[model samples]
Each structure stands twice: as C-alpha cells, then as structure tokens.
Target: MRAPTPVSASLDDLEPGDQALVAEVSPPHELSAWTAWLTSLGFEPGEPVRLLSRARPGGDPLCVRVGGSTYALRRAEAACIRVWREVARR
Candidate 1:
C-alpha cells in the first residue's frame, strides 16, 4: 500500500470550505489539547474536519466543524496538525 502524503500547513492555513482528514498528529504534543477537546465533541483521530470559518484578525484561532461539532484552535497548536485530503463522502 502507498503511504499517504503529509499535510504541511498549519490548521490556520486552511481556508473556509476546505475539508481534510487527520493523517497523523505531527510532533504528537501539538495535538494534545486538540485531541482531548475533539474527543469530547465526538471527533476522533482520522475523522474529517471541515473548515467552517476563520476566527480573529491574525488567524490565531480557526473554526472547524468536525463530527457535527465546531471547534476553535490556535495557530501554534495547529502547526503540528497533519492531515490528508478528504475524499468524497459516500
């Protein structure tokens, strides 16, 4: 099987309307906080996340909807977030 390509941009770099699947947590610690938060919202690792909107001026926080719940994440933490392009939903 072929290995998946790595997503290089921070979560803050994702534009509104974009969707991606969590490929892996880069650096691991980057996702520590996010993982806990997402779990409470039913968003598990490898789930799809839709970029719902941008938050704040400098793009420090991003609004993403995952598993029917919306979440706000910081840019620094998002930098370590890795993802793959989300395929079409069946």
Candidate 2:
C-alpha cells in the first residue's frame, strides 16, 4: 500500500471534517507550546486529529476536534501542522 501524502502548514489551513496526525514541528523550538496546548486537547505527537472549524474568518485560531474534545490553536503557535490524506488510510 502507498503511504499517505503529507501536507505541511499551520493549523488554520485545515478544513472542517479533515483528519490528520501530528507529524513534525518545524524549527523544533516551538515544541513546548505545541506540546502543552495539544496535550490539553488530548492530541499527542502521533495521535490523529479531526479539524472541526476555523475560529474566525482569516483568523489564526483553528478549532479542531481530537479525541472527543475540541481545541483552538493559534496558527503561529502550531507552525508545522502536517496532515496526511484520509484516502491513504484505505
């Protein structure tokens, strides 16, 4: 089977109902903030996340539903939000 395609971007780029796992963080320095915020929402480094909605139009906050909870994150805080295509799961 083929591996999933990776899309690297900030969390704000994700669309509603989109699902993906946290891949790598760019620069690595922002790991602490990312870890803390994600951990609070039950999103571990390798856990899957489902995009629920964007906080506001053209805003940096992205509202994502992960592990039955919703999380709002700033785009800059999550600098390297990588996601895989759901089709690759099949």
- The prediction achieving the highest lDDT against the true structure is 1
Off by over 4 Å in 1: 1-9, 28-43, 86-90
Clashes of each: 0, 0
lDDT at 77, model 2? 53
Error of 1 at 22 (Å): 0.7
* Tens-digit lDDT string for candidate 2 (12-52): 46677777776644435745566555555565567777777
Error of 1 at 51 (Å): 1.2
lDDT of 1 by residue, 1-90 (tens): 455554545455678898887654554664476666545654456778777877668765877777767777666656556666633333
Cα error, residue 4 of model 1, in Å, equals 13
Model 2: per-residue Cα lDDT at residue 38: 54
Model 1 weakest lDDT span, ten residues long: 81-90
| lDDT over C-alpha atoms for residue 88 of model 2 | 59
Relative to the unseen true structure, what is the Cα RMSD of model 1? 5.8
